[model samples]
Target: MVSSLQKSMINLTQVLRLREHQKSFKELEKLGAIDVYYLEAIYQLKEPTIGTISKLLGQSTPNTNYHIKKLVNLKLIEKRIDDVDRRVTHLTVTSRYSELINSDEDFWTRTQERLESEIAATDLAIFQRVLRQTIEIISEESREDTISD
Candidate 1:
């Protein structure tokens, strides 16, 4: 049985995640529909592959590839050939876009202020720890189910 504190923490994280998603969606809408998903995917992922992105976004490889090609054409992301394997390409955010996205001082400052005001450091740390553990547990369960099937 989950404690009330744990339940509240889960709800708070869900609300925060939803709010961020809404904010990101608004920002993407300002860019363009295709650009919105591309930017959102890039922002969420560390070094996501085409297949991983396709799975996450509920898009087919062909569709994802088409958008990725357009993003490449627009110079938002750079696709580099992996040094270890010439046939393997890795997608990375371009320096130009990194500057544009990272240099949005107003957004960053406002977000920082809101977080500082709303979330305590200790609570935030606990929330992050629990979230990570929950993700690992769920993933392990999924793998077990897959093996059983």
Candidate 2:
């Protein structure tokens, strides 16, 4: 059952990625796998500094900086110097990056519309509750791991 659940999650992720790639083929082409990965990390982390990102990724500062520089050059991300700590720089995704990546929101919206049309309302509510629980479980585990680290 767990394996099946994992497979479904993986399939969902692949489908989303495919949809995003199709929607932003040209912009996606300009980005390498590492570029996208780093962009996602930065986006999720909100305003992580270079050192924080390096630690989270278990990568060297220089290696992380290389990709960060590439992202900045591509205008996909912005680096802001910390106001309180001048030496620390925080990373943020740019509007261009949001525009390119948020195509997946359309995919989700469409999927929800279709699901609402096909599924019974009660069943959909139950599925939604289960999905929320799963996400919360994963988030709690991630927080635990981060705290431990």
Candidate 3:
């Protein structure tokens, strides 16, 4: 029999719900049309300036501004000028955008509650620990790859 962990990996790889439905997938698709790199830069850069974001995206300032304008129009992100350095403008995701990113909170909670009903808490804890360690290991490997590259 396949282990729970193996089943989980299979489920994640096998399911393509996000790609199958247009209406259901609209938000993600709209954001993706702007390029996944913009979202990644917004997440990883921590309120970086447009120039910084442009550099991170390997795009010209005009191109970065164009994407940023799209993000702003979509209400996915907001911009603020620095008080000390007016030339420095910072970009940040709106709280609503964060909520959109975390849209599966209710689904996960209901799934966990059902899971708890079917399994002992100790077993659940072990499963959670394993998942956490897996995430950490993947993160470490990614960092090592980045550093080596």
Candidate 4:
């Protein structure tokens, strides 16, 4: 059951990613694939340091640093000096990055509206509850994996 669910989720992700890629071709050209991936990691991690990002990405510090420098130059990401440890820096995606990435997207909102129109309200509510529960479970598992690592 879990394996089937995982496959379905993977398929859904691939479909969504394809749609996003089609929508963001210009942005993709502006930021190379690797840099965009690094930026995504930084954004999702919410202000992780170089070491933490390197570990999460399974990348060498120097290689990660190189991409990070490029992102910084592009003004897509900024480094913040850790308040307690001045030597340590945390990475955050900039407002410009968010604007560039999300400003032109309303596909999700449109999809939600379509779903509301097509699905019965009670069924949609149950689907939403299941989706929320699944997300929470995944988040908890991710946290556990991060903690163990």
Question: Model 1, residue 46: displacement in angstroms?
Answer: 2.4
Question: Any idea what lDDT model 4 has?
Answer: 0.83
> Stretches of candidate 2 above 4 Å error?
104-106, 136-149
Report each candidate's C-alpha RMSD, comma-separated, in the order given: 5.6, 2.7, 5.3, 2.3
- Residue 114 lDDT in candidate 1: 82
CA lDDT of each prediction against the hidden true structure: 0.68, 0.83, 0.73, 0.83
TM-score of each candidate? 0.55, 0.79, 0.57, 0.84
Weakest lDDT window of 10 consecutive positions for candidate 3: 16-25
Give the lDDT of residue 118 in candidate 4. 100
Which regions of candidate 4 deviate over 4 angstroms? 146-149
Indicate whether candidate 1 or candidate 4 has the larger TM-score.
Answer: 4
TM-score for candidate 3, please give it: 0.57
Off by over 4 Å in 3: 1-24, 110-149
Candidate 3 or 2, higher lDDT = 2
lDDT of 2 by residue, 1-149 (tens): 56987999999889877766677657657778877878887887788888777766677889999989999998889999999999999999999989876656776798899999999999999999998998778756754565566
| Residue clash pairs of candidate 1 | none
| CA shift of 21, model 4, Å | 1.3
| lDDT (C-alpha) at residue 106 in model 3 | 78
Winner by TM-score between candidate 3 and candidate 2: 2
Ordered by TM-score, highest first, the candidates read 4, 2, 3, 1
Positional deviation of residue 91's Cα in model 1 after best superposition, in angstroms: 1.0
Cα deviation of 101, candidate 2, in Å: 1.8
